[model samples]
Every structure is written in C-alpha cells, then in structure tokens.
Target: MISFSQVTKRYPGAGGGYEALKSATLDIQPGEMVFITGHSGAGKSTLLKLMAAIERPTSGTVLVNHQNVSTLRASALPFVRRNFGLMFQDHKLLYDRSVYQNVVLPLNIIGYNAAEAGKRVRAALDKVGLLAKEKAMPVTLSGGEQQRLAIARAIVHRPSILLADEPTANLDAAYALELGELLRSFNQVGVTVVIATHDEQLQSRLQPRCIALAQGRVTQ
Candidate 1:
C-alpha cells in the first residue's frame, strides 16, 4: 500500500545540509507487518515520518495507496492521513482529556456523530482491553494503560495502515511486550503495521520483516 522510490531527505545545516535518508527505496504491501530498526540518527524515524507525510523527502517519490504524496496539494493532506493510523513515541494523549475523549478525538475531527463516535471509541478501547478505564484521565493511568490508550486512539478511526515510531520507548519490558503483542494482533486482522525502534528485545521477540538502516541508508 506504500512505496518509496529512490527517496532522499535532507535538512539544512550550518555547513551545508544533512541527509536523513539516502536513495532509500522500499515497498510495504497491505496486511503486511514490518519493523524499521536502527540506531539513533539512523533514519528509521525519518522513514516513518516520510510515509505519514509528517516530513517530505528532498528528492524522489513517496506513494501511498497509489497516490504520490510528494505531489499532493496542502489541502489534500487530511485525506491522506485519514487513510492511515499513526502512533508516536510519546503517546501524545491529552492530559486534560479522559481516555474515552482522547480516543474519540479523531472521529470528532472527521465529523462523526456523537453516537458513532461512542461506538468506535468503545470498540477501540475494547481492542486495547481498556474499556473500563475509558472515563479515567490519561494522567491517572499507569504507563502501560496510557500506552494502550494511545493505541486505542490511533486505531479508533480504523485506518488501513498503522505507522508507529518507537512505540515502547519509555515503557518497561513487560509493557513493551504487551504493546508489541497488541500490534501483532492488529496486523493479524489485516491492518498494515510498520514500527520503527532501536529496541533489540522487541526486534528479537516479534521478528517481523525488518528493514535495517545505517547512516541514513538502507543496509538490509
């Protein structure tokens, strides 16, 4: 569902420019689960961001579901993001909002009715096994619960693909394993999953199709 063709991303630096990705070409098919693993500054996160259009490449093309996102107009970005779910390292939940409300945010953004939003929110929470904590605020939850809430929020919209960057970064190993299992379950149900991380324990455990990177280049 996604393809990167000779993509390169460079950022302006004091001396000249820094390249985060160099001539990277890869493809991810629907229902496929994959891992993008590398050390810090190795371009794993850059690849994820590029796929989500959070960052555009300096050169080459990024195509999502056959649409060349690099060429899409600004107004069309919403439509593009609507096709995929994204989970970030920090969870990024609103501390002020209740878990239910946080999960319902995206549905509200797309104008789903209150009744429909509740249905999706509850379903997503159920998927993460957090249905009972729906009314609790994010700050009140434990780290694992908060991360699960974040997963619920991401999948509440039922996007065809899910892109996660360092999803278990700050969590304990147990929580990390829980989250990894949850993601694998999502992929089993046909949601394309791509995760970028430096965690070797996670890498060894899940064993998904791993694309390794080094110094901004794909090494495997």
Candidate 2:
C-alpha cells in the first residue's frame, strides 16, 4: 500500500521554485487497481515517482507498505523500489537487444541465476502474449508489441506493485483496450496496479477507483 500525506514536490528555478505537487495526499491500498487521471503536468507522474522513492518529497510524507520512504536513506531506496514494477509512457526498451534479453535485464541486475532468470523471462513474455517474439529485436515489433514487451520487462521480477505512467498514450484504441485488460488481469491476481492516464475512455471502460488531479492538487 502507498500513502501520501501533505506531499509536495518542487523544482528550484528562477522566480522561486515550481511546485509539481501541492500538498497532495492520497492512498492506494494493496491489491487495488487505481487510476490517477489528470491533464498533462497535473503531477500524475510526480505522484508515481514519490510513491516509488525515485524523487524525495519536498515536504510531508510518503509511505510505502508502512515504511516512511520520505526519510529512507539513498542506500535503502533500491530495496524499496524492488517492490515496484514501473512502466513509462515511452517503451524504454533496448532497441538493440532481443525481447528476451530486455526482460531478462532486471533479473540480471538482481543477480538471478541463468536458469531462474530464463524461466521468469519466458513466463513474463508469455503473460504479455510476446513469447513468440522473444528472439526478435525490439525495432522489429509493432507499437502494441513494443508496449507489451515493456510490460513483460516490468513484471518479470514479480513486483508487488505495478505503476504505469501514460501506458496507452501511443497505442490505438484497440491496443489500448487490450493493454487495459492486461493490467486488470494482473490486479485480479493481487498485484497492486496504479495507472496515470488522461484517457477518460480507458478509465470508463475499466472503472477503477479514480483519483483526479488539477493544478497539482488532488481534486477528487
């Protein structure tokens, strides 16, 4: 579970700092599928970053699974991040690597042995319907396939929470719906799913607990 209490994130610049989030507070419970809906620059991305401890809050607190991430040391951040599976608007795939290689990277980083890593990589690819493309280069896949590959890579480590930022931004309607169903499936099996998107249609179709943001504040 994630909780934010009066959290604010500011970036320093001339004419005072810019606040990306203004005392925003919200809670995402374990195994819940939640959507953060807002226009561009409404702090959806900042909220996700704060939840994952990628960026420290400028004020207030952020708690993940009862740990105060706002005060966690840099060395402890990685351990906290391990519990989260992150997907970005950009596919962020290694174009030069094969799909299998891309998904296996996370396991490799955590020192998973070759046999175990191979099994996980294949399983993740299969879950995203990309098992057959394991040997293909990322550039060879279609846009939808590329996004599926990214999802495979994110879930290969079996993270407790899945956080996606504008995941369907680049996909067509059909593909976007397919991806939404895929994420919902993960939530059904108990992975906490948090998606930040502007697509009202997607939210309407899925009907997850909605959290609306406006001008960096939680408006709903």
Name the lDDT value of residue 46 in candidate 1.
89
Q: lDDT per model, in order?
A: 0.91, 0.93
lDDT of 2 by residue, 1-220 (tens): 8999999999999888899999998999999999999999999999989988899999999999999998889999999998999998887899989999999998988889999999999999999999999999999999999999999999999999999999999999999999999999999999999999999889999999999999899999
List candidate 2 stretches off by more than 4 Å. none
TM-score for candidate 1, residues paired by index:
0.96
> Cα lDDT of model 2 overall?
0.93
Could you tell me the C-alpha RMSD of candidate 2 in Å?
Answer: 0.8
Q: Which regions in candidate 1 have their CA more than 4 angstroms from the true location?
A: none
Q: What lDDT does model 1 reach?
A: 0.91
Candidate 1: residue 105 lDDT (0-100): 92
Clashes of each: 0, 0
All candidates' TM-scores? 0.96, 0.98
